[model samples]
Target: MLIIPAEKSLDWKNPPWMTLALMLACLVIFVFYQGKDPRLLHTAVQHYLDQGLDRLEAPIYETYLEREIRLEGEADRRTDLEAFRETVAAGERASLAVTMLMDRPFFDYLLANRDLLMNGRQRQYWTEARVPIQQNLINEISAYEAGLVPAEPSLYTLVSYQFLHGGWGHLIGNLVFLFLLGFTVEKALGPGRYLLAYLMCGVFSALIYTGFSWGSKIPLVGASGSISGLMGMYVAFFGMRRIRFFYFLGVYFNYFRAPALAILPVWIGKELYDYWAAGSTGIAYMAHAGGLVAGAGLILLLGKGWFQAREAFHEPEQEEQDRQFTHDYADAMEALARMDFTLARKRFEALWRDYPDRPVVLEHLYQLAKLRPDLAEYRQRTRELLNQYLKLQQPDNLLRTWQEYLELGEAIHPLEAEEHNRVLFAALRQDDLKVAEKAFARVRDTGHRELVREAGRLLADEFGKRRMEPKANEYRLLLKTL
Candidate 1:
């Protein structure tokens, strides 16, 4: 009869790894866009080469980089690199054209370079490009503010900010965390809501960061803002549940389960510590704080009692266990009435331990339990019964017997089987088969012999659809036994 609170009932079975994967993907793109420096470009080409992208698109990306270097400034020059850059950038649609041209001969290269271009080099590129990036974000926001699009914060920076990062360590750390947390949260919330939440959190965090650190000229990057949002919601919804983490150091590994709620205090403390230690050491702590709050609030709103009430109320499994006990008791009586000793013995044996105080019923049930074919402990039940009956004495035992019989027959008091069966028989005579079947089954299930026979006959005749041989034989057999 215990009821669990609706807010506490969240499906926290799986970790939010999907959200993390999404964050990684976003990280790669962010790195590429933000980390476009000569060293980064060289590293990207090397990575593409390592990944077997050289044959597909490495040459093309190299060519494009060379052209940019030539137009901007050249740090390194080697062999066919210059021609390759010119050829690729000369196309009508440089980006798509470069992609198409490279795909045929250097597909792997494109993928390899994709991580480099998207994630950025320590995001070493240039903060100047971020102006356009932020400007584009502001433009998108303006559209919404001007009523051209929905008032969605996600559109402002969620997509773009995922690619931004503080430095190599900052980028890698944020991305790794994002990949781990994003996937799971996304799956739990579902794609659309997860995507919306992620982007909104990112946008909100970015705005907060910009407001406090205005014109500081730091190329604010990293998925921490969005990923922090996921962590916040996770802790809010799953609270005290243990979350497993695998800590890694060079060639060593260890695991531990920490309460989900602990993440918030630790995270907040770290941000505060960092903000004080180095006032904005390539991390947007304000953004992370804002994102965490937003995520927790959103999940709470969604998990509210009213929202839960809109869905069907699902009681905890204990209710099912109770119903199972009741059902087994009912089934035991039905089996005993049909002389299905095998099933009855099993059910009564089960009930003996579960409801031992009902000794009047247990006397018969104890006898039935003793008849269990595979019972190795029947002797113990018999001794218990003898001891119980000894306590009842003559007068009390006789009174208990009459009380049990009255309960079994319903001839008096709680209106037993006598009148109920008559009513059932009358209904059967009038061909009100449904009523007859219900009443007869109800009485027969309690070892009411006459009622069982009547119900079986009516069921065979009226409901069995002209009685197939198997059914007729079964009914006849049951009737004969009764």
Candidate 2:
């Protein structure tokens, strides 16, 4: 009986997706109005990527004015100079060819699909790319104004460049995690608030990422920071829900769930451990930490209510009953543990009557029923308990429960085939021959064979009673094959 109470209804907060869309639209409009077309920026980026891709495939040009070194001769000096110049010329040609081949295709693709890949292109990209760039660009602009900047503005980027990825694997890995974590907090917090929360967390994560490598010129690409933020929020919003994770565990597809809160320590501890080890193998542990902190902090600030919501149990009556039952059960077990059978018997006797139908209570009663068999009242109560248990238990559970009773030195009921025959009859009547076979196999008596044979005869009679002449005649032909 799983009932979701009215109290469990989701908060009617702002929708994150709608808010993200609207906010992004305004940002784009602002950029557009300021003469900075997003399409142009995307095109520029695409061109840069295309240039890299072309260089990968382009043939390197090698030219040489043959320089045969004549030891101790004037030809050595003259030949070396010509060779050096040709080598330089060839390098220059190769660079130009790669750049030219890449620039056109990348820009052309961007121009053709700017609308598709820009605003409404990939909703995830906004969080992945734009948010990090916004923070870094803002910081760069601030530093530039203060005149406290390096002499040459770097074309090789750092934090802002982490959003750009080369291939489908690059984009998909980041996006999948982003959607998984982002969607959870987004749905919980609602759209509008969720967008702001996402962006804010992204910026915070970026600052942390950059803080570690303040002057790094290499481009760091991916939406990992934003995704980390969502993970942080996940811990805050849904602390203890079990999330099943998939990972290789010695070659078997082993399954397990981690409480959301417990998973945090694992992630944070791994990052911290790796950072301390100084394993600079390209993973930005700093960014993950930053995003984690931002996500956790932001959710705590904005969604303090989310934590409280989880603590709340909607069915007060059921919660009270369960709590009381637990306390009583624990006390009785403790008495049993202390070897005070008399006290345990008294406590179990009282609790058993209250929850006579409960499996745990009935089990306790059955265990005590043997020792106190002289108490005729207790013995009668045990019999009634067994009868009630058998009625509700499934076949497998019935078999197990009955055995448990028998093991307790309780009298076993006659193993009647009628009890099992009812299930067999129902299965056969529904034309479920597989279930009939399974059910019939469980019945103890050979007398049950009559019921099975009767069902088979009834099925055959039904086949004879079919109204369709073509089907009936087809059956006759099939009977000849049989």
lDDT of each residue in 88-108, candidate 2, tens digit only: 567654444333332222333
For model 1, give the 10-residue run with minimal summed lDDT: 142-151
In order, the Cα lDDT scores of the candidates are 0.54, 0.51
Q: Which runs in model 1 stand beyond 4 Å of their true positions?
A: 1-24, 27-35, 39-159, 166-169, 240-259, 305-482
TM-score of 2: 0.35
- TM-score for each of the candidates: 0.37, 0.35
Query: What lDDT tens digits, residue by residue, belong to model 1 across residues 1-482?
Result: 11111222223464455554575565665456443443433443344444433343444556655664588453333333654555556642233333332222233333345555544542233223322322333223211122111113334444565555545777677766665566546545665667777777777767766666553422445677777787776666666766555555577666667776666676667666666675424456777877787777677787564212222222233455568767877888899899988787777877767666657556766566545423434434444554565455443443333334334433322334554465455565556665665566557756778767776786676656755667667666777888
The worst-scoring run of ten residues by lDDT in candidate 2 lies at 1-10
Model 1 lDDT at residue 249: 58
Report backbone clashes per prediction. Answer: 48, 11
